[model samples]
Target: MGAASLVALLRYSDWHSWLGYMQQPYLWRVVRFSLWQALLSSGISLLIAIPVASCLIHRSFYGRAALLQLFSVSMVVPTIVAILGLVVVYGRSGWLYQLFDIHIPLYGLVGILLAHVFFNMPLAVRLLLQGYDLIPSGQWRQASQLGFSRWTAFRWIEWHYLKKVLPGAFVLIFMLCFSSFAVVLSLGGGPKFSTLEVAIYQALRFDFDLNKASFLALLQVSICTLFAVVVYRIAPVNRQDVSLLAVKRYSLKDSFWAKSADALALLVAFILVIPPFLAIFDPVFSPIFLLTLQSAALWKAVLVSLQIAFPAALVSLLLGVSFCVLARFCMARRYLALLPNKIEHLGNLILMVPGLVIATGLFLFLRDLGWGFQSSYWIVVWVNAVMALPFVLRALMPVMYQQERRFRAVYLSLGVRSWSRWCLEWPLIRLSVAQALGYALLLSLGDMGVIALFGSQGLVSLPLYLFQLIGAYRLEEGACVAVVLILLCLLLFYGSTRFIGGRSLVKH
Candidate 1:
């Protein structure tokens, strides 16, 4: 798909025209804004995440475990839903605004930064916490025995693990922010604040400037590809560590300043989490919220969303499995010495391709092929599957490699067929498989970019429906849909994790 899109761009666009378009001041502004905001968002998220993760590591507060789990909710929450929730807290008529009689615009760069931090900061915290959890307990004992100060412990011990973990986390968050579309669309206010992804959408969808859109899409792809290469070079390879039985930590010396800082960090984390839940739950008891439940359009959208999500998730899982299997097989047979690296590069490339770019490419390709918007349902499924591919691979590859390492010789010696080999391995990797499926499902459920582009009046998914409701100034209905969407995604994720196998191996 990526190659086809690039070919289409090159076939139609002249080099001189593309270079001229690239030289425009407005184009530079878009590029500048995109890169600048992404850098700031990633940096700010990591800065906040370190202290929050550290506090969580050292403190045993009530709801700490639940709070950690809540961090995962950001992953599944639709961007529009999250933006709406943020508006409810920070917009002109929001709770904060009403209480303080202050207007904090939930649009432009401010909104973008706020939205990015809300989504990515929790992810950073989770990754950092995982890193902290992997630290050997004896290391903490050693630091304590040496009478290390808080600063000494953090600098000598905590920073050591974080140095390895933070770069990857930063890169992941930066890429996510770079690819942001729904948030930029809903909150950017105008083109002045637009990112490259949003600019691509505008060029194609609104201006009908296919040539310009193609050039911009190619530029976006090239920039993302460069970032992916850099990330692959810099990020440390992940190794599966046996779960730590217990994480030991030296008790902090009692101090007022320390307690206040921890309290403040927890408060900020809670602030990040509260608005989304509030946006969902607080509207449930409203009179119009129940009325939305009876709307036929709501039910239709739910059915359409389910139809798209399930197949997309399955397709993504299949593609990820096929990639892992092919890579493993090639490596085993020495068929292609660079197959593993190529496969890894492909996965990273997919991770960097924004959904908007994929949707734009498919839309153009299908239009050229005479498959009109009538085939949008299938197009949506295909794009969602592709977008979900990276997550599926990330979740499954490590386990697959581990299984192959441990079982390949045994299976070969016994002359095990492919089917029997899979059966033997299924029990061991089922949990990871379930995770991959759930990740894909949740991603498809929350996706807005592709559907926003491809959805017709006759075929509206829940995200599209919710977006329409918000656009039509039906906040009550939008809120109701947002709540239902959140519940549906969470239910699907939990069900996939719990019942996909008789015994679930997911620990956290």
Candidate 2:
């Protein structure tokens, strides 16, 4: 079938003519620009996050706990909300540009990088900090007692721990940037700087070039699948310990550098964290923001978002539960679950598929079906579900494992039927379910991809509507909507995690 498709592609069909454009120097230029920007952005975010994470882990200061919580909150804010703030702050009319009188623009590759960093830096901090948590407190004190310098202590103690988690972290960040669609779409000033996902969107949505879209989608899938497999192979094995230690505390010595590092981490964390939150609030007092409270369209968009998000979250939970069960009970088929006894690979695989690729492929399949439901609401729901499944799986996997181990003898002695057992086991798994559903809802709420394709004049999710507001230069309304979106996502996340992670995860 691929051979036939290749022949058809080479036959100079009208739609396939765009294949020549793919090989054109200008297309490669866009590809080169995207690659460089993603690499630069990911590298810079990791560099900044690593030291700050180290400081957060290695020392204690006033408000240290508060700072960590602040960072965690930043990690959950939607990309649209964060990037909207970046635009308002760094764009031509923004406070910084006007204050500095700099004519430079933050609307192209530079804008994309800043937005990516703003969205991703907190993730790096959290993951690396978690890595730091894995290391015993004694290791650091031992190195200090041995008279090791800061560099020596980090090189000997922290470096090994960092190494254990670094590959997974790097891969996670890379996949995020690689598949990054919303930021690139919003910040990319024109077609000059675009990722594969954006390119696929242009092809499918604007040009209606299905052949070209299919080819691009295939290319993306092949590249991402191979990259995921390679990263999974090299990822450190079973590096995360199941046991949680007593929270270790540290007091920074009264040295100039120690003081400097803490201050630096605090400053960086604050700068990265604060503006988006305030930007959202700033719009609330505007006339348009006030008017939006009475607008039927605003309420409609909210209802649409809720409808998509709820079903998507439910689907994600169901899929995640099935996956968890298959991995747990079907021991021999466990290898079919991707990485055995490890959470990283399965999560990475789900994360690696660029949102655009999945949306494009499904669009084509539906188009070929010539069905009436192609542009219906269900497509958005399914795409959101798929996008969210990985996160759901990640949240539930550990909880499922712990529950299984905790109740193994009890279940075995009772000869619990696999499907019926869940009736009795649901309470133990409820927290995990909550966490999974919470993440799924957030994912769906923030999604702008599939809906962008299938969305019509009559159908718009909140993210798509916000994009339109930005396109139409309704910044204040966009900001207000952004605030509303963030709040809803936070509520879902908080409620779910509060239950899922309560005594079970904490007791560990």
Candidate 3:
């Protein structure tokens, strides 16, 4: 589907007409806005994440575990819920302005940046902190003994660890910011501040300009693909953890300063995180009528989400598993090893090609393929299954790799075939498989792209249903549905928690 879209795009000659429109002053302005906003959002998120990660690694203060958990809480919150929180907190009649008389605009580039940072910062902090936690405490102590200042210690130890993964982290965050859809579609007040994804959406859904939309989609995909490739190439692939065995210790010198810095970092994290929780919670408890719970349409949407999510999760897991196995086998075949690192690259590439672009591309491709079953439902399900591939890979591959390293010899001696291998290995790696399924469910449940493309009389997922509620000015009902959606996510998260508890059953 994606390949056909690219092929079709290349065949056009009046590239001049499309290129000219792309180069138009307004489009250039939009591109510049998206670029800088993404950069700044990623920067601000990293800033918020780093100090907190540093403090957590260095200091074992009160509620230290809780603080770490706090940092992690935002990692799984749905984007739709996050946006709703932003609306309640910073919107026209939000509590902030009511409490402080400070009216902040929540509908422009600043709002978009805040939302992006909100969604992305926790991921950055967690990733970077994993690096920090891996650095040996001995290195820190040795540096301190050598009269190395805080900056100097960071320069030698933290800097190197951070540098190893920084490009990849930045690239991932940038790709996320670049392809932001729900945030832009909801909070982007006007077309002037739109992104390429939003532009593609507006072109197709609102303006109905097929030629212009297709042109813009091709351009967006090209730019994003190039950036993804460059960033992946620049990122380091191998660097072992140094702090894995580091002994935890309380620092003696300058405890006051460390405490103060830690407190400040906690405060900053608090401000960034607390609002969304409050926003999501406040509406649920507020004397708002719970009409959505009574509506048959809401139940239908829930059922629809379950049907799509279960199959999508299973299918995505299968595709991800296949990709992982293929990559593992390809390691032995020198010629195949020389091919593009598709397994590693495809996820980010998919992210680069925004959901709308993929949906549009898939729609066109399916239309061209002359499939007998041409319902929009199949398109949504297939694209969604593909979209869930990245989450599955991220969750599953690490476990699979670890298992292969630990038990490869045992399995090789037994001459385990494919089905037998799965029977043995799946139990050990069930945690990762479960995590992948949970992530796939959460992601697809919230997605609006596929439904938007092949939208039908009866088709509705939670996000699409939420969109309809919001469109009809049923804010209170929308909030209720949002709460239900969030609870479903929490249920998934809780189920994943069992994997952590059962980790002891699987030997490394």
TM-score of candidate 1 on Cα atoms, chains taken together: 0.88
Cα deviation of 179 in candidate 2 (Å)?
A: 1.9
After superposition, the stretches of candidate 3 with alpha carbons farther than 4 Å from their true spots are 8-16, 59-73, 130-153, 240-254, 330-342, 371-374, 403-428, 499-508
Report every candidate's CA lDDT. Answer: 0.79, 0.69, 0.71
What residue pairs are clashing in model 2?
A: 431-500
Task: For residue 501, give model 3's deviation from the true position in Å.
Answer: 6.9
The sequence of per-residue lDDT tens digits that candidate 1 reaches over residues 386-436 is 888877876677667767766668778999868888888888778778878
- Which stretches of candidate 1 lie above 4 Å from their native place? 130-153, 234-261, 326-342, 367-370, 398-428, 501-507
- Across 87-194, the per-residue lDDT of candidate 2 in tens digits comes to 677777875677887654677888888877776787788667656756666765666567765566677777788877676667677777877888888888887878
Candidate 2 vs candidate 3: the TM-score winner is 3
lDDT per residue (tens digit) for residues 1-508 in model 3: 4565455434433566876796688777777777877888888888887887776666666776554444444654667777888888888899888899888888988799888877778778766764664466677777767766455666777788877767767877887787778888888889877888777788778876667777777777777778777876877763434224334533434456667887898788778777877787776666654755788888898888878777776787788888778766664466876432566566546666666656666666666667533556766777787777766776665556555555656777888768898888766677667766777777777777667666666788887888888999989888888888877776765565465435432211
- Per-candidate TM-score against the hidden true structure: 0.88, 0.83, 0.86
Model 3 residue 221 lDDT score: 76
Clashes of each: 0, 1, 3
